[model samples]
Target: MRTVVFDLDGTLVDTSGDLIAAGNACFRDMGLGDLLDPARDQKTAVRGARAMLRLGLERAGQLDDAVVDAQFQPLLDHYARAISTHTTLYPGAMAAVDALTADGYRVAICTNKPLGLTQQLLTALGIDGRFHAVLGADSTPTPKPHAGHLIATVQAAGGDMARCLLVGDTETDAKTAAAAGVPAVLVTFGPAGADMAALRPAALLDHFDDLPAVVRNLIG
Candidate 1:
């Protein structure tokens, strides 16, 4: 069975704007007052909340692991309240999904984002039903970079792992696919798009408009 699994944050949607805002809220509570700039820190935002908090706290000369842990939930709280305000699906993302599905491929989302938040964001974006299955960090005992996450996601989507492709925008995603012995297709339009080449994914995708051909080449 052919399957395509996607990473949520930077691969499927540009959630950096809202993610940065949530990190900034935590910084403000620390009296740091928006230490991370939205435009300049989109890469860190895509890395996740702890990375954003670390960047801001380090910038303010207040880097501390304990502090980051303490503020994590609050940042998540702020994120949940306005998760979709600035989040957007990458251009032609869903259409690519439709094309793949129509060609008899099953699609799933395997992301490091928490399960609840993944549901929230997908539902808010009104694209939850586009996927056959959605698995997040909490869905498995081991997340990305571990073969289990990809294997479990494939099982959940009712597709065999033998003919699978993983699409993402980060090294972790590439590593996950490698561990699962599947091809990794990294998107090249995110903040660190240029740097993705270093990860040595099976393919580099510049735009979703070209995904169907790319997936056909790689998966078919």
Candidate 2:
């Protein structure tokens, strides 16, 4: 079946709020008191935990790889405690998923988030069963930007790589699709939405309401 692979943090859901909070929690642990702003640092948040840590450390004049490495686990712990606190589904997200599923397409999540945390977020959001497969950075030996990650996710979802496209919101996702020789339909609904055009994805999605049609145009 034709398949749609989605990037979790910035694509399907607005997870930036919770993600930024977790980054701030790490700073708070250092007695720094929330170095990252939940609103202004959203793009960095979706970039991943390390990105947030880097930004905070830079702001605090303490950008050190060792410090960031040390705080990684604590960040995850704090995130797990409040993973769903400010996270939310983007407008028409699930409705779009249901639309694709109903139209006989296979849908799956391929996120750079750790597998355990990805599971926690999806479960907390009550969306764990929505996809045929939910692969994270640790799910396989390789992650996004590597074709293996997307191909492996397609295999896990019982999808043919030749008949798939990615719905995502970052250049990482664009690179993943490019490396895998597939179309990338990037979403324009977050802090960096306008910037997605520079990545030159097969299509730019302004809203989930336009996704099913975009997918069809790209791969079907």
* TM-score of each model, paired residue for residue: 0.98, 0.98
Give per-residue CA lDDT, model 1, range 143-192, as digits (tens).
99899999999999999898899999998888899999999999999877
lDDT of 2: 0.92
Task: Write the residue-wise lDDT of candidate 2 on 151-215 in tens digits.
Answer: 99999999999899998989899999999999999888976798999998899999899998898
RMSD of candidate 2 to the true fold? 0.8
Candidate 2 residue pairs that clash:
none
